[model samples]
Target: MKLALGPLLYYWEKQTVETFYQQALTSEADIIYLGETVCSKRRELKTRDWINLAKQLADAKKEVVLSSMALLEAPSEIKILRQICENGLFKVEANDLGAVQILAENKVPFVCGPAINCYNASVIKLLINKGMQRWVMPVELSRDWLIKILAECTQLGIREQFEVELFAHGHIPLAYSARCFTARSENKAKDDCKLCCIKYPVGRPATTQEDQQVFVLNGIQTQSGYCYNLLNDVPSMQGLVDIIRVSPSGTESFTSLQDYRAAVNGTGSPIQLASKECNGFWHKIAGFQTQQ
Candidate 1:
């Protein structure tokens, strides 16, 4: 299976973001996804900067993909999304329907990002018709459901030529909203918010009444309280997933790449070392609940 480093999900200083990608080069991942997947307000890296970083990583012998914003709310955002689609380099991941429309119009090969809501093989077929070269399962889809989708694809005579990717490890990106939770937490309105997300690099953790971490607030993205570590599931994922996504949360999270690498090669135990263990999502249960 291929290992991919997902794009940065939180705000960071320009140099800090650059240093993380440099460190990623030596990690066990084969694919490095560049570009911002969240709020475009975070100007730590511009479009040109992301393209430059993609070039550097590609030069390092890594497959690179440019990812688009998951929640686009403005004309400027759509304008840039168009610019990214026109960027004739490596394949791009379309996180929203707008990106899909742009890429489809150009007949450009692109990846269907997780936020696309491809719940069945029919949706997958529709995307395949639109030149989708890759597909990422929604974070909520379980292994059984994924297998079912693939089976349906076979029965429908739709060749699943598209590579399948999974959110194997990271803080589960549960939802995206127009409301900036991070900004609200900092007592700032979404429109006038000054980069408050940077203050909580890893996101402000929201715990339950029992003091168990349940969610993370990053701008408008709400991620799972527990890191979704799928180390133990790698063996089962071997032939199923073409690429496993390891999200870059903050600097400390890149260690996730090594641990996932060890799990990939069967040398390390990821479930044993996860900051907060969680397998319920794989089991199709409550996402935050843990299981052995």
Candidate 2:
């Protein structure tokens, strides 16, 4: 199995973002995904800058993929989607139908991102027929569900020949909305909200009345409370998934990516505790707690 570093879901300073990827180039991650998939208001890096970064990573022997925004609200967004489709160098990750259409129209071999809701074999085959090079299961999909889908694919004679990637680790991105919670919390309107999400680097953790961390808030996106850590599960799931994706959380200097890569390659020692790690959705359980 290989390690893929997913796109940065949070907004960071331009220099900080660039430096993170530079360090990630030498990390245990084999594939690197570039571009912003979150709110478009966060413009720390332009499209050209992302392209340049992708090129630099590609030069360093890492497979690079450019991700599209999950929500495309305007014509300008479509134009940006067109630009990503027209790039024609690195592979594009389609997060929305608009991106899928653009990539299909341009005949670009692309990846169907985790947001595509591909829970069945027919959907997978449809995308494959449209030139989808790879398809990632949604983060909420569980092990049994995945097995069933793969079985159906086998029955249909389309059993994930291209590649199958999973959101193996990170804060599970639960949902996105038109309303910006960061703005509301800061007493600002959604339209003129002064980029309040920049205040939370790791995102504002949502807790219950008991003060238990339950979710994370990022502008309009809701994410999981416990960061997903599936380091221990990789060995058993060897051939099921081609790449294990490590979504960006804190700074990239911590070497967790390398640790995951080591764990996947069976070169690193195993941890005693899988209880602390979460495989809830992967195991088809309630997501707040672990499932081992």
Candidate 3:
């Protein structure tokens, strides 16, 4: 299966973003997703910069996709989405209905991001009719759920028309809100928060009273505290998955990508980075629990 690097969910400085992608160009990731999928207020790199970056990656023989914001609250954000959809170069990943509508209206084929809540074959069929080229399975769905969906698609005779991309690695983006939890955590309002999320490049951890991590707070996004890993499960996904996505995390993200690529090629074993890892959602259990 091909490897894809998911968009950066946490806010980072312009230099950091650029440096990350520069190194990513040489990484084992076959597909790289650009643009901000979190708060639009994090404008370290503007629309033009993301398009240019996408162009750079596309020129490197890597499949590039521009990802849209999951929570769009302002008109300016919609305008940015329109610019990405109308770029006429790389394909766009629709995270919200606005993006889907925009891409559909423009007669452009788009990939459905994990945030789009595509639960069954019927929804997949509707999106396919609207020009969806691929579907990134939602982070909460299990292997059996995907089998059922694919089985249903086969019954409907549309299974071969699209590809399946799974969010295989990284912290799961659980939810997005109008309220910026990072700013709120700093006791500041979302508007005048002074870009507090930049302080936590890896995101702030929300721990339970027992000192156990429960969630990760990154700007407007709420992510799972444990990193979601499927390196060991790569063998089982041979025919079922077309692409495996690895989300950017800490400084070891490139190493994680190497590990995933090696595992996919059957040359090396999966590397354990974070102290905690979760494959529970894929096994149909509590999202934080790891399953063998």
> Cα RMSD (Å) per model?
1.5, 1.7, 1.2
Count residue pairs with overlapping backbones in model 2.
0
Arranged by lDDT with the best first, the candidates are 3, 1, 2
lDDT of 1 by residue, 194-265 (tens): 988999888889888999888999889999888887878888886678888988876666677777777778
Better of 1 and 2 by lDDT: 1
What residue pairs are clashing in model 3?
Answer: none
Per-residue lDDT of model 3, residues 149-209, tens digit only: 9999999999998999999988899998888899999999989999999999899999999
- Looking at candidate 3, the ten consecutive residues that score lowest on lDDT are 268-277
Candidate 1 residue-wise lDDT at 92: 94
lDDT value for model 3: 0.91
Best by TM-score: 3
Model 1: ten consecutive residues of lowest lDDT: 268-277
TM-score of 3: 0.97
Error of 1 at 183 (Å): 0.9
lDDT of each: 0.87, 0.83, 0.91
Over 4 Å off in model 2, which ranges?
A: 252-254, 272-277
Candidate 1: C-alpha lDDT: 0.87
